[model samples]
Each structure stands twice: as C-alpha cells, then as structure tokens.
Target: MFNLDQAISAWRRQLAAGGIKTPEVLDELESHLRDDVEQQVRSGTSEEQAFNSATQQIGQTNVLKVEFNKVGLAKWWQLPIKLKGMLIRILGREQPFPFPDLNTFTPRGLQTLELAREEAPRLGHDFIGTEHVLLGLMKSEDGIVLKVLRKAGVDNSAIKAEIERFVGVGPVHEANMAIPYTPRARKALHLAAREANALNHVHISTGHIFLGLLLENEGVAGHVLRNLGVQTETTREAILKDLAGS
Candidate 1:
C-alpha cells in the first residue's frame, strides 16, 4: 500500500538533501508536486504512478536548485512585507508584481544582465552602472534594443564610443572580486520589472531594460543616449511599437 503523504514527504527530503533547502522554496515546490499528483490521480493514474510523474515534472533537485538560485529566490521572498509593499507602490502597482516565486527574465534578459556584469569589469569599473547595462543591451544581438536602434538609424558603434568616452577606464579590480550594482543601476532593474508589468509580460527582456534605462533618465546611460540624439519619449514609443507588433 503506497502512502501518498509519506511518499511526498520523502520526496521533499530528497530535494532538501540535493540542496533545495529554503523553506519557502521547498513549500512552493511541494505545493506544485501536490497539485500535479492530485491532477494525475483524478485522471485515473495509480497513486504511485502519480507521485512518480509529479516528481519527474517538478524536475531534478539539482536543476531546480539552479533555477531558484538564478532568480535570487531567498532574498526576494525574505523581504519584509512593508518593504515589498513600498516597492510595489514605487513601481506604480496597485497589486504585488506578478509571479513573485518565479524568475521574470527571458533568456535574452538574463544574458543581458550577465553581459552587463561583464561589461563593468571590462571597463575596469568596480560597480555595474546604467552605462554597463546599456552596453549589455546593445551587445545582446538578439535583443530588441538593437532592433529599435537600427530602426532609428542609430549606429551601435557610436553608442559604444560614447559610453567609452563618458565612462573612462577606472582602476582595475581583482578578476574574482564580486562587483555590485550602483544605486542607479539597481533602480534601473526595478524599473525594468515595472516595464514588464506594465506590458503585461511575464518575462522581462532587453526591451524592458532599455525602457528602464530611459526611465532612469538621470543616469550616465541616459546622458549618453541624449547626447547621441535618442529622445526618451520617441525611443519609448518606438520600443512600445516594436513590442506591440511582435
């Protein structure tokens, strides 16, 4: 006699042993497992079969851990309710931002973030700034930012030249040293989330990031764009149009 509750508990322990240790994350994963098992059982699957299927669908423990880590799972959920509420309000949201448990970044969006981190070091900067993010967006060949720039007849090389000129090389740091985001860069990320929410998009992309840079118009990226003849409103409209058409 296979017991579902015991089986699920054992499965959770396996996940925990495999490094999916955060309580909230474990609870969330268990909830999903239960839902899947319940649905499969309703479809006449045997209890054992349903449990096995659910575990497989939930994915391997190591893979799930990697996915959760990518989204900063622990920090995001550990935020104080009041602070979370304040962030929601700041993003112009009446409700909490959607899918708090899941990563909102598309593949390209994640790549852009990684590239931005790389760009900061390549420029010998100790911190990631909006300028690095701008370079990241441009460097992402599949990003919508490049599409918009091309449509606007703005040269990518020109933008790179401007960023390099404005943000000259700084003292080099150790290659293994962890770089942090500047205040404006952090704000830009928040704005990117807001842009995704406004567009009813579950996943944030390079286009949303570009909009974030535009919204943070006091940043170095904003100044570079302005100097190169990219109007905030017009660029915004163009991005919106492109997204809409796509």
Candidate 2:
C-alpha cells in the first residue's frame, strides 16, 4: 500500500536531482499530475493507482529534465531575477558601474537601444530619449517589462496607436545620420543606470530602463506612459513582485 503523497514527494525529489531546477516548472508538472490523479479517482481508481498512473503519464524524469534544459540556453533566460546578480559575478570577479561595460546589459536592454533608434524615425522624433526607449521596451518579447505591460492591458500596438493619436505625424528623419538623445532622454538613461546600481544590480535590464523613464517624470516618455494608464509606482511595484516570484 504505497502512499500517494509519499509517491508524489519522491517524484519531486527525483525531478530535482535530474536538474529540473525551476520550481515553477515542477509546480506546473505537479498541477498536471494532480489533475490526472483527480480524474482517475473520480472513475473509482485507488489513490495509489491514480498517483502511479499520473507519474508515468508525466513521463520519465530524465526526459522531462532534458526538455527543461533548453530554456536555459541563454544565461539570462534561466533565472531572470538573478540576471544582474549572476553576470556581475563573472570570472569570479565583479565591477561597479564606470568600471562596468556594455557586456553588463541584458539582451532586452540592447534591444531597447535598437528599438529606440528605429522608433524615433517612425514616430518622427529626431532623437532617441526616454519616450523612444520606453516604446522600444514594449517591442521586446523577452523583457519582464512586456509581461508587466501586457498584464496592465497594454501592448506595443496599443501604445503606438495611442502615441499616434497624441503626437500626430511630423517630418520623418533621414536615415543617413543619427539623431541624438534629447537632454531629458539622456538624463533618463543616466537615471536608469543609477537605478540599476542602486539595487546593486550588475546589469541594466528592461525593468530598470522602464524605471528610469518613470524617474524622468518630466520627459515625453513619462507623459506618454502616464496617458497609457501605466502609473510609475504601480508598474514598478508589479515588476518587483514579478522578479521576486521568479
């Protein structure tokens, strides 16, 4: 008479040993197992039988471990909450900003730079700044910022639409030369860098960048984000919670 709870507990230990290190992943698998078990019990199966069958259907631990391993291909994708912490510890060494390099930027931070560059011209802005960078953050699929925005009932398309309504159209810039960051936009990015450092974070991420924009409350990006119903404090708190949960 094997105990169902014991069986599940043992299964979890096996998965952990096999390198399914994400608790969320294990939680989801457990959820699936429980669902299967419940269905079996409803059909009059014994609890032990339900547990056994559910475990088997969930598959061998090694196979599932292999599947979970793919999610860690990029170092940042594995544990986003530790992205800054981990990178700052590379080669058994660490450096603070001014000593830090561009290598300290998360993938989404780099993407934000690109998006800001491209979006400036599209929106008829002559320079990249907090507003443009904020828009860029929305374009990223990998960033935590997008998740928060989506949860807030906002998306890139919706934001662009709102911006279009607010700013109408202006003279499109030629792609030959680069436009510069407005003074406020430059200050926003500087603030973003400071924000990351204040958290003792090694890398600048999309969340930090978003926070930077909010900190620049007098900038165009801040105004736009506000119009879109993203309160700085509310979204910042949401981002912190997401990171903690991760």
Candidate 3:
C-alpha cells in the first residue's frame, strides 16, 4: 500500500539533504507531489501504482536537489524585507506600495533598467544601482512604469532629463557591465548593486531596490500604488517588521 504522507516525508528528507531549507519552498514541493499522486490515482491506478508512478514522474530527487541548490542557494529572500522596512519608514502605516510583480521586472518590461545603468555616470553617482534604476525609470519617456506613474499625475520628465544631462557632463566608461537582463526577466538584479551601495548593507539585497523604488521622488511608487487602490505602505511595513523580528 502506498502511504501518501510517507512519500511526502521522503521527498522532504531528500530536499533537505540537498540543502533546501525554506519552509515555503518545501511546502510548495510537497503540494506538487500530492498533486501528482492524486492525478495518478484518478487515472484508474491502484494506490501503490499511483504512488510508484508519481515518484517516477517526479524524476530524480538528486537532480532536483542540485537544481534547487543552484537557484535558491543564497539569501534570495532578504532584499525585499529591507525594501519594505524603508518604505514603512517613509510612507507610514496607511499608504501602500506594490512591489513590481515578476512580470513587470522583465527586461522588456523594464527597459528603463538599462537606461538607468547607463545614465548613472551622467548623474555623477559613483555607482549604478536600484536607486539609479528608479531614477532611470522616472527619466524614461517610454517606460511602462512611467506611464503608470503618469496616470497618478506624477511628471517624472523633469528629473529624468536632469539625470540625463548630468551624465552628459560626467566621466564615462567604455565597458558594459550591466547585468545581462532581458526586458522580460523581472529579476531586478540590475538594481542589486545599487541597493547594496545605498543601504551600506554587507551584501547586494532586494530590499535596497525596494527602498529605492519607495524613496525616490517623494514615494513615487507609493503614490502610483495609491492611485491603483492598493494599500501597500502598512501591509509592507508589517511584512518588514516580521522579517526583522525573524
């Protein structure tokens, strides 16, 4: 007889052995396994047959272990925690800001990210980071994030043009070190370097970018979010406090 819970336990053990410790990731994995087993049982297979089939379909746990280690191996979750804390400090408890979704961070979606990196030198900023990226998006006439901000009555053109002009008079470098990001890959890694610089944090973090997005231009992100009817300031603050406590 196939023991569903036992199979789940085994999978968890396998994942843990592979070095994945996040409860959220582990929960998601278990959910997928259960779904696979249930699908097999629904297909006229015996419970034991279903269990065996599901296990096989799941592929080699060792291979999965290796893959997960590659992607989630670092502190990928800390960036946003820092960003939320900064946003709370600025926007307070009632206002809300929406972090750009995965879709919005894509290279295609974030064309301004490249523009921001290139523009940083002109602005006399020694480093190109997320703050510069926020500045970049604000300056870009073609960025969708700018379009969203426009809907909320924020005119970013003045600041955008100013940054461009500043870079025009500043020292320039010939090498291209911009993160090889696609407009479609919303990783926002282009801003990681900047985030680290701004917060004086030991490592490049997502939270700094989050703060960059929030603090740049009188809470431009928060304002745009308010227009969209989402209350981010408080919810994000709570999330920050929770992370800090943990």
Q: Pick the candidate with the highest TM-score.
A: 1
Q: What Cα-based lDDT does every candidate model obtain?
A: 0.72, 0.67, 0.46
For residue 129, model 2's alpha carbon misses the true position, in angstroms, by: 2.6
In model 1, the runs with Cα more than 4 Å from the true position are 1-102, 171-177
Worst 10 residues of 3 by lDDT: 76-85
Candidate 1 local lDDT, 179-238, one digit each (tens): 556556667878888888888988888888888889978777888899998878988998
lDDT of 3 by residue, 1-246 (tens): 567788678868877777766676666556656776787688877767776776565556675555445432232212222222222222232323333443434343245656666654554333344435656555555433444345445456654544343323334544255322221112344343344444444443233344344534223233343444434454345324432432
Spell out the clash pairs found in candidate 1. Answer: none
What C-alpha root-mean-square deviation, in Å, does candidate 2 show against the real structure? 18.7
lDDT of 3: 0.46
Estimate the lDDT of model 1.
0.72
* Clashes within 3 Å, all models in order: 0, 0, 23
Lowest lDDT 10-residue stretch of candidate 2: 80-89
- Model 3 ranges with Cα > 4 A deviation: 72-246
* Candidate 2 per-residue C-alpha lDDT over 1-246 given as tens digits, one digit per residue, 9 for 90 to 100: 677778888889999898876676676678768877998999999888898888876678886665445432422212321121122122112212232245777887888777888887776554454667877888775658888888888888877776666545455755424455545556677777887888778888877778777887776677677888987788888876765554
TM-score head-to-head 1 vs 3, winner: 1
Report the Cα lDDT for residue 215, model 2: 84
